[model samples]
Target: MIFRSLADIEALERTPCEQAIAARTTYGLIERAARLHGARDAFVYLPDGELDTAPQRITYAELLANVNRAANLFRSLGVGPDDSVAILAPNIPSTQYALWGAQVAGRACPINFMLQPEHVAGLLDAANAKVVVAFGEHAQLDVAGAVRRIPGIEQRQVLWVSAPGAPTPALSQRANEAVFEQALAAQPDSLQFDPRLSPERIASLFHTGGTTGAPKLVQHTHGNEAHTSWFAHMFYGFDENTVEINGFPLFHVAGAFVYGLAMLAIGATQVLPTVLGMRDAAFLRNYWKFCEREKVGALACVPTILAGLCNQPVDADIASVKVAYTGGSPLPTELADRFEKATGIPVRNILGMTECSGLVSIEPLHAPRVPGSAGLRMPYSEVKIREDGVVALRGPHVSPGYTDAARNAGMFEDGWLVSGDLGRIDAQGYLHVTGRAKDVIIRGSHNIDPQLVEDAFLAHPGVAMCAVVAEPDAHSGEVAMAFVTLKPGASIAGDALLAEVAPRVYERPAIPRRVVVIDTLPVTAIGKVYKPALRLRAIEIKLQELFASQADGREIVVTAKERGSAAVADVRIAGAEDPALAARLQAALGAIAVPVAFSFS
Candidate 1:
């Protein structure tokens, strides 16, 4: 049941994918579940604002029947294997069926509904999407405009799904788009599903961030998805009696694959929240009450949601929750400990990325957790840290590289997927993620890891969350800067909090020179800290201070030259009133002299 070493992992695999998929193809799994558990409820669409309406439920057999109908409709639109069926919709039962239907006929590609039209257009083009399924309206975004902007897509290629109670949009009046239910109503209840799909045939298209800029479209095969689902089953001990409430958005890989698709894959029931999930104040306000009412056995979670829920008071500990798995970012030790104490549900902080399908490792549900570690590598996968400490993995679950050939270089080497995360395998073989290798701050000759600095701040009793980033310094080349948030109603001042943590830092160069207290840290859809934005803010604040402290009060021009992880500042001084301007600047940068030089404007 547990793998303590690589040998134990190897012993668990018999002919790997061959035996793994012997009884279950991705679509075949659906057929087996429907036939086996025809009467069992597979999904329940809980109301958002209208609690007066009863939750709409779907049985396994009904789900498969609808998926088949939807699949036939997709085929009528020329969707086939390797073809992309782009999805843009909120978390709804029909959207879930559309996901399964798309995969039954072709690859499923769900774009973040929050994306701009241009971003959606790029994703559609990248996938060479044949069709797009989207909602008619949304409160925060223009779904119609995004659909319009996908290059070369016709109205006929768009399938518009309606909201729960909203009247169907007049798709017929518009020549370009069609109503989803109307199109599916025209198709027969059953459509032939090809059971001959090779494990290597692509099953889904998901985008992950690039080192320099644009996101890369990751290719996950049926084999990749199925393997991870099986891992989820084994890791969580999922069974037909299992009921899970998924809060992640449907478009996210974690939601589409793990919480939604994977839940169905295991023949378990899924309960959806109202439109907005974690952000829905009503939902968050009544989360514990809802869980108790629904008999939620395992809650799919992220650190952000877990942190938010921890702030809300709990009346009593509910013993029904088996475990709450959180991934997509580092889980602070304090947050995990606090959450368990508050609600009695263990947070299994997980580690994975889009490129690796979903999850590679997570805290063992039954074992003692490492305070700051993600967990041991899953039995289906193998992980190694590169010489530079970047966690690298080799597994059947790992995607077959990205579609963009330009992004493959240095991204994968030999058989290992080169994760950008900097981490180390502990003596016990648990993976402890340190920080991103590229996000380090270089002070003179010393490299300061931001996570180390962040950990120092998180230890403060008042600090709820924190992010440490590199700021360009006129003296020390670069200095570590921290942005932090406090526990609700905690009134600790910024400088006082910094003083408490500064001496606690192991090294002088590693200590953050600047600390800014903010209400909250910017988070990605998947709940990870958005660090690139933090890095940009750090540079702006550091440069503004440099411009203010010119000893001669002279006009100066400054530019940043980034070499490796270091941020180098070149200052040009003109009409300098004091000869000690350069010296004064050097003294002000940091305690240690930076790799700074001066010139005339």
Candidate 2:
């Protein structure tokens, strides 16, 4: 069932465009694939969330029919071209319907359910969604807060995906509301869906995580969507029988646009776990076992998942795996080496943002990989690093811009999508991402780039994972603080870990003021560590515990006049400090290094 490697990938003969409609816009890539591979399995998923039983498979014919049904159901609900429908769920068979239905109807906005309520509301309002398709409990909880903010959007029309044994929340019970099953019942099981679409028309809005403000929505045209899938088909070199594993969240571009849709475009069968976040021990164990049983061919996993897979002692039927592409985060050199050593499969790192619809660049097969590079640009794509260390890309598959003008303006420069990620392009053209532009830490007069600090820690054998952020110090405006997750059987204290990194780094004084030992770092759906979240958490520690537990704890007590000022200062210090302090004061303030002069008086 699993076709391993690009050699095993079957290439479908391109069907000549019908002369009558040759000039018309036809994003019929999926439809053509379905027709060519009618009897072949197109998608597979477990019937239940927690089960080891064989996956239930659906052929391309059934997939086409289901997509048609989904289109019909959306049309029945008054959905049409230009109207936006929102889907908030994990990687599942149903996600395909929501997405493809969008293409058949109008534009679909795949909103990340993991976002906070206000963030969710912002996207819903931006997309101007009419119908929302989501899981029962999670959707109700997420949308309830979002719908409250946007009074114009009705909360009653939500279609709850009824999960077994899970009750619809009391908040979701309403007369105008409709469940997914009810909607499907009204939809014809088989119907031909032929919606008029233009190649340049907006087909999907992919929301990406923002650095400064709320998430920005990336507009993908019908042509761009198909082009992206075609590019992925060529990049992955998918064949007819590729056992594609669908584990990343479908809400994101990597899951929804790249792997999920690309697999369908190539007539490949996709296997997905019943639930999201399968990187945990128990879930991964079950996943690998299933892969062995099903003989999965390829997996597009995140760096975090790959690390977990390497951490554990597993011997599954990974023999079918030919290429394992890890993206959404920089795959650690050590982890990639370990994975290749263990499974004897190349784990190529991929780098792209949601703006590019994912897979803008990737390490090609049999190519000599640089230690930390994410490989060369994919076919039909051009990648370049700007003078400011930003990754910029331009290609047919690239999205135009987001809904917000300000965001769009910042995202693109002279038509090139300027990814705010900092990276270096080597002589061989492999890209080595140094760090995120936003994650940079300014220490005193020196710019203590987090990527530089992280790379220093990465060189150490004991350090498994690390994130560097600016922590407030009274002396230095801000000092670098490193949160580290150690490797198994590796024990190194703060001083020892600091010593390992001290020699290699140029900023001797800019060395991490303190290294906090953490069990694990927070990661987004794509495996990129959520450094902002970690930085926020670290700031809280510095405020309530690190700064609060100072010897002058009482000395920090303010007069009635200074009370308000002190409270504001405390809050400011908790989050960030003036970047001028490090140079002003020779010694930096850290979680442990309390300033000797503790009084503002």
Candidate 3:
């Protein structure tokens, strides 16, 4: 959809539509433009065929009409301002309509469909949503079971959408209640609402994938989100002519706020591809072809998604793409280099969270390459390196605490959002994120952080992905264990990984003493590896079995002893001795305590 402000591009002479533009906010731009260019194309999508062949274009007039009708429907159904309406769907055209319609009347919450039932229940309850719009087959929407288990949804209404003639879910549809598609089809296509919006009106609430504790509901206001969306547009340099393709799930703030709304705020053409398995080779091939055919200008991807596309050689017409933004988790340096080299598009790193409306810092295209940075702070953001070493920020885009008090307690400090990410800003202003502070592991008086070890593994070509965990160790307090996933058709032994990381981490006792091969590491909905789960599994594994059998009850310990005026403590355990380990341990803990005694059990 092209806004009137952007339509003057093709006209040589003074165009009637070309007028100075000013809007209170991003939504204002969308809502106000319907009056002048009500019949102009607002969004174009295609379920099949090339971009030029029979694409569906919904005009601004039609969009406003349908939005008003849906808002009226919501009002008639008792959905007033402050009421919550949640949507569970992909980036289908309807998803936008549902969200915008709800925004016109009340708050809109978009839940991730990939979440399990309990997770969905938590969000539903947190949102206090009076209505939930979901697909017919959504397993998380078992209305009967949900009512029984979650008290918050007892009298809540459920709306189901199914294919045209298909039977709907038994609970909500047996009585012929409100069906999604039918509701939209029945409503007249246009409406308008008064605009006296504020930054405090909650527009959406998203829950992050908490690694250390329970996920907290992040509350964002209209002003907060509009500013974030505008900032993204400014930083990404998107214009009305930009054709942006979004395959990312519309749940996370980054995906929805940064990429999705930013596209709309710029009046750019946003493409929603068919919902297909990200790993399906045919889907990847076809999607790439679609990008080339449509001449997609901007796109965002996570590392794993990019890695999948890179596995096979593709000589498609990706040369049109100008910017490839990537984040959510650290992208492997090798993967970033390969993607940029192959596509001729620079991959800009971004750092953000659900609490901050998706983006905080973006590594500009002109910035020099830094190994593991999430880029520098964005234009409107103010970041501080707190004394405790955690990154904190305060900005218009920052959300207030979650609704739940207990969950809010640890998330904020003074007035700033205490971002859980651990990072430092260099004198040159480049930020290098090391790892989560809580994930830091200390073994035998030696501190071993997971990110350092993971970076080491990423340097190996055969190692497609890797995770490091702290396994419980009675001798050294804990031992660093590495889990490696090799590239497809590539085989690398555990010994090879140990050998590779051994030299890099030799000076520190945080080096992995054992390595194991796994097909893949468990990842969350947003593509972050589950390190807590990996640590739990690592503790259960017995590394001694991989080596030759030692005496079943064998054990040894070396104690601390004094050297000159300084006392040094030493501790070592051996099932099968390799003098190299002892030397490493002694060097790791030089001045801790004197060596006391040695015992064999």
Give per-model CA RMSD.
Answer: 4.7, 6.7, 9.6
TM-scores for all predictions: 0.88, 0.82, 0.79
Predicted model with the maximum TM-score: 1
After superposing all C-alphas onto the true structure, candidate 3 shows an RMSD in angstroms of: 9.6
> By the lDDT metric, which is better: model 1 or model 2?
1
Measured with C-alpha atoms, the lDDT of residue 424 in candidate 1 is 86
Model 3 TM-score relative to the real fold: 0.79
How far is 58's C-alpha from truth in model 1 (Å)? 1.9
Ten consecutive residues with minimal summed lDDT in candidate 3?
Answer: 1-10
Best by lDDT: 1
The CA lDDT of each predicted structure is 0.76, 0.67, 0.64
Candidate 2 residue runs with Cα over 4 Å from true position: 1-27, 47-51, 137-156, 163-173, 189-193, 210-213, 279-281, 444-449, 459-461, 473-478, 488-491, 504-510, 541-601
lDDT score of residue 24 within candidate 2 = 22
lDDT of 2 by residue, 432-474 (tens): 8877776777666777777667777877878778888877666
Candidate 3's error at 72, in angstroms?
2.9
Candidate 3, residue 293: how far the Cα is off, in Å:
0.9
Q: Which one wins by lDDT: 1 or 3? A: 1
Find the number of clashing residue pairs for candidate 3.
18
